[model samples]
Target: MKENRSREMYEEIKNITKTFQPRLGVIKDEKGNILTESKQIVDRWKRYCEKMYSSDSTADQQEKLEETREDKEINLLPLRSEIEWAIGSLKDGKSPGCDDI
Candidate 1:
């Protein structure tokens, strides 16, 4: 019964995806050039992302890290009572996180 339900859901999702149209029909490059081909669009996206991420200044990052190190101080872990209180305050019926616990 569970397997049949899972199969039905998978087929439903597949049918839905078949009817979907991609929103990004075309992409524009930084030079205002329009890309229609799939390869051109993908390459343009890759170059754009690379240029964007690479534009960050290493000197500014180092200065920011140094400022953070000077200002913040490490703190000890919470008490057992505090931990229990936090867990107890969580509402019931909430879904488990990534660990599924």
Candidate 2:
């Protein structure tokens, strides 16, 4: 259990230490499961920085960029129903039951 916790911590720290240009894609876990792949999230950060530093970029361009980014994000992948259902159940204070289907 300690080893597992240590590995998880290391993974989290490794993620925190990276500095890179934002690319649109999913980040995966050790088991190749996606942790986050929200293009909207990445777009928001870029837009914020641009708004602060790149004063020449107009609002119309930003709005168009947002629309393109959103379309990419929506089409990149879809979540499994089981995962969504379980998340909803936990959020609603209900138990997630196992499905044999």
Candidate 3:
């Protein structure tokens, strides 16, 4: 019947996530120390994700697009009568925006 009630609700949510044991409660460090074991909270989340994606310098610190100026004027091509007035203001079977078209 609905695939055996979705395979008995996926084996009762995989045996309630195999007896579930997730608490990760204490974790502090960055000199403030606390942690609490499970291998020092997995080596403090692998040294805070390797110091948040380690990058001392692979150059390009940014800034040049002719040094940057345009506080306003930014047309970048839309006008075909503004894409036919946004497909004539959408409404038949709606949903399209967020590039979901």
RMSD to true structure for each model, in Å: 10.0, 18.1, 12.7
Quality of model 3 by C-alpha lDDT: 0.73
RMSD of 3: 12.7
lDDT of 1 by residue, 1-101 (tens): 47559888988889988875768879988889899999999999899777656747556777899999888876868899999999999889886666543
TM-score winner between 2 and 3, please give it: 3
TM-score per candidate, chains pooled: 0.40, 0.20, 0.25
> Per-residue lDDT of 18-71 in model 3, one digit per residue for the tens?
866898678988888898878888888898887666663222223334345444
lDDT of 3 at 50: 75
Highest lDDT: give the candidate number.
1
Assess each prediction's global lDDT (C-alpha) against the native: 0.83, 0.68, 0.73
Model 3 residue 91 CA deviation in Å: 75
Query: In candidate 2, what are the lDDT values of residues 1-101, reduced to their tens digit?
Result: 46559888888888999788786465554455555648755655576676766646676678889999887755555469877886666755545687677
Best by TM-score: 1
Q: List the residue pairs that clash in candidate 2.
A: none
Badly placed stretches (over 4 Å) of model 1 are 1-10, 13-21, 55-101
